[model samples]
Target: MNAPASAIEQLQLGLPELDWITDPNRIQRLSQDFSWFSPVLTRQLEGKVADAVVRPRTEEQIRQVVAACARLKLPLTLRGSGTGNYGQTTPLAGGVVLDMTSFNELLWLRPGLARAQAGIRLNEIEKAAQAEGQELRCMPSTYRSATLGGLFGGGFGGVGSINYGPLAAPGNVVGLKAMTIEPEPQIIELRGAEAMRMHHLWGTNGLVLELEIGLAPAQPWLETLAVFDDFDAALAFADQLARAPGLDKREVAFLASPVPDYLTQLAESLPKGCHAVLSLVAEAGEEALAELVSAHGGRVSYRRTAAEVSKSHKTLMEYTWNHTTLHALRVDKSLTYLQTTFTPGEYVRQITELSRRYAGEVFMHAEFLRNMEGQTNCSALQIVRFTTEERLQQIIDEHRAYGVRINNPHTFIVEDGKAGGDLPEDVLAMKARFDPLGLLNPGKLRGWPVGAAS
Candidate 1:
């Protein structure tokens, strides 16, 4: 019914220097994430909560909190910004929640790389990088509020992924410093491909402290939307722009008619009964992009420079990815999403097949991307009109039958059989060494006890 007595007592008695939250109301708020985005996750984790919340202001305080939780055998869930869509921060098994937001600090910055405390907001990191003539290679749609560490831990890729690839791809993230849960917490520094061990583990393995990420030259990005009477024309224009040389493309998102209709903020920009392509292209390529759009039988409906967009606080990024689901949900609460990847060569066919079958029930929303192999491809964050759980499962099964991979957002687990399909042995092995007690974000991983993970 409560957290381990030893952990609570030791944390309360030993750490008077720390900020501990005992108020049920505040703790309840801290214990939640955007899990309500998924009806299935909402139903399962609606009432779950953490016993207490401990905010560690510094890395030393974090080590102390880890040592105490480890010694007392308390499950610890790490949270940052709480902007994640899945129940990545939900404490299914009650314990101490180590709030990492207060651990904000920019450690260092260079021309090609930047390092900072995990709790620093991603927008802050990008701003700091931009000041140095550099930028984050990729960022989530929730860039304004999402912490860089949380984004790295729970997110894969976003706007910049078109040019740079996912978080774990090559040099997107070059370094990571994590703290193991032990009586005397040990520090683990991961570099190169080794850091992939915790890239998107949802803070289930190691507690991230600081990160050193690779940077790209900051671009004068333009957020533009192209409207088309034919959905196929929109997709063709997007595909052409994505592979166009000398054209710097960040996000090339394709949305069917009603999808843009649900985007209340830009409803006027998108004509009724027309499909849309929301893109973030470099300022230098605007003329070429517009030309391509015209050639594809479409019109460039909306265009704004990054600085202008910042002044207006209107971003095309939010209309893509999972954020599309967020906007659609506001219009119709009975809607969900699926993370589907259509690999190179056959992705168009796969999308066409599913689109033909699902039709209006599952509206297509695609973000064109380049996979790790540098192949031009795409992933779907399609908005689904939720009917029943059984129907959802049937759709997923149908996709799998057609060799279309689907990552069910409705479930929260590191191993969703989407990316790797098989068990993540390296991640699990690292967890055993770092959190031998498996006390870090326990039930978030159904593969608890380590054996189940295998």
Candidate 2:
């Protein structure tokens, strides 16, 4: 990569019409994200301010900026709401940080589909769809603050994953308009299988300009928070709920233990000495849901009727599993997290053992989802109170030693989507075709050419 030119003047002359921020403090702030698991390393990775941070409001503006960067041989990094956890958007090599938030717009909403500008918040688009008696098919825990482009580029399974699967599945993405960094950056619209491949590529393949997604009919949902006397019962209940037929929509499911006092707030009305399982469902399944809880030795501690849940959709959506975990971490100044996936067969026993082993050091918080085979698969995000950075690394190493696949949570990125797949050689060739200069998020995505600086 070329040595960065004088930050302010280079960007000023490169895209004279675009707004550019060169102040050291402001640039530093834009470079980092909400990744608290490894605060010190997070800051290190987000080191140095870009010569300029540019926010483009129109596709034309984005293209113009890209064209100028290509001409100057400057690296460009794309950013959305910065809600990612894997350092995916952090400018490791400072260049022009393209803030995509200003491009927010709801471009189209028709039966079974909705399209919006890359920068639109997930909640904003869902609200517009709900007014038309429809809604987003799936959204991550951070929907309220997460932008559409951010989710497409850097999101994974959320509370609703049990029903809709991961966001990268073909059923979720219908099309996308992206700007590639070939000899001449050009805007291209892709649909069907091709578009699905682009979902969750971590902004490596190209910069998403707009998104067309599949939508689901809006249903009156009932929210329930249940408390279990033991962790075993909570995990079993969640697994049973996932397998239960006639579940209108198992939107969000979470199992929390005492370590994460955040649940103490949501389950405040519950009696002491109990773990909790929270869920959201369509109103029509209330009777059946009650039976399922009873069968698993659990009781609904707090219930929001369909009317209440509907009225509070925006708030409920914002506090998905991750938000709950974030709130708990805030209670303790020294807390970080871990991301791991496990099969449902022995989830209860495995989690219980691990929690007991780590005891005061680790808190167990789980979000349920389904594997590609339709079997129960889950991602458990473990938040641990702060300790030495070396000890934290040891904890992650120990957890992985037990056979769980851990996607280190210290970064703003999550590993999932088609980007995780081994693509055909032609697919790699195609990437080279669009990114001849190898300037797009270089080291990310499958088949991404090697030897490019991350």
Give the top-scoring candidate (TM-score).
1
State the lDDT at 203 in candidate 2. 72
Worst 10 residues of 2 by lDDT: 412-421
Displacement of residue 8 (Cα, Å) in model 2 is: 5.1
Per-residue lDDT of model 1, residues 1-454, tens digit only: 8876465877778999899999999999999999887888899888889988999898889988888887777788999999987888888788888899999999999878999999999999988888888888989888888998899889989988899888878888998898888898888899988787887778988888999998999888999989999867887887888878789988889898678988988888988778899999999888888899999899888889989987987788877888888999999999988889886988767777788789989989988888999888889989889999999888888887888778778787767724346456787788788877788888666667322321
What are the root-mean-square deviations of the candidates from the true structure over C-alphas?
2.6, 3.8
Q: How many backbone clashes does candidate 1 have?
A: 0
TM-score of each: 0.96, 0.88
Extract clashing residue pairs from model 2: 84-412, 85-411, 85-412, 85-413, 86-411, 86-412, 86-413, 87-412, 87-413, 334-386
The deviation in Å at residue 319 for candidate 2 is: 3.7
**Runs in model 1 with CA error above 4 Å?**
1-6, 417-422, 449-454
Q: Residue-wise lDDT of candidate 2 within 1-454, one digit each (tens)?
A: 9777563467577677887776788787777566544665565574544666888888888888888777666667788988876666666556778899999999989998999999999989888998999978788778878899999887776756777777866678888888887437887888877776555656766778999988888877777777788777877887778767778765545555664345445546456657767678788999999998999898887888767765665445444556756766667657777777775586766777888899877878777776666666677777777677788778877877887777666633323322133655555655665566766654445344333633
Highest-scoring model, lDDT? 1
Error of 2 at 441 (Å): 3.9
lDDT score at residue 280, model 1, on the 0-100 scale: 93
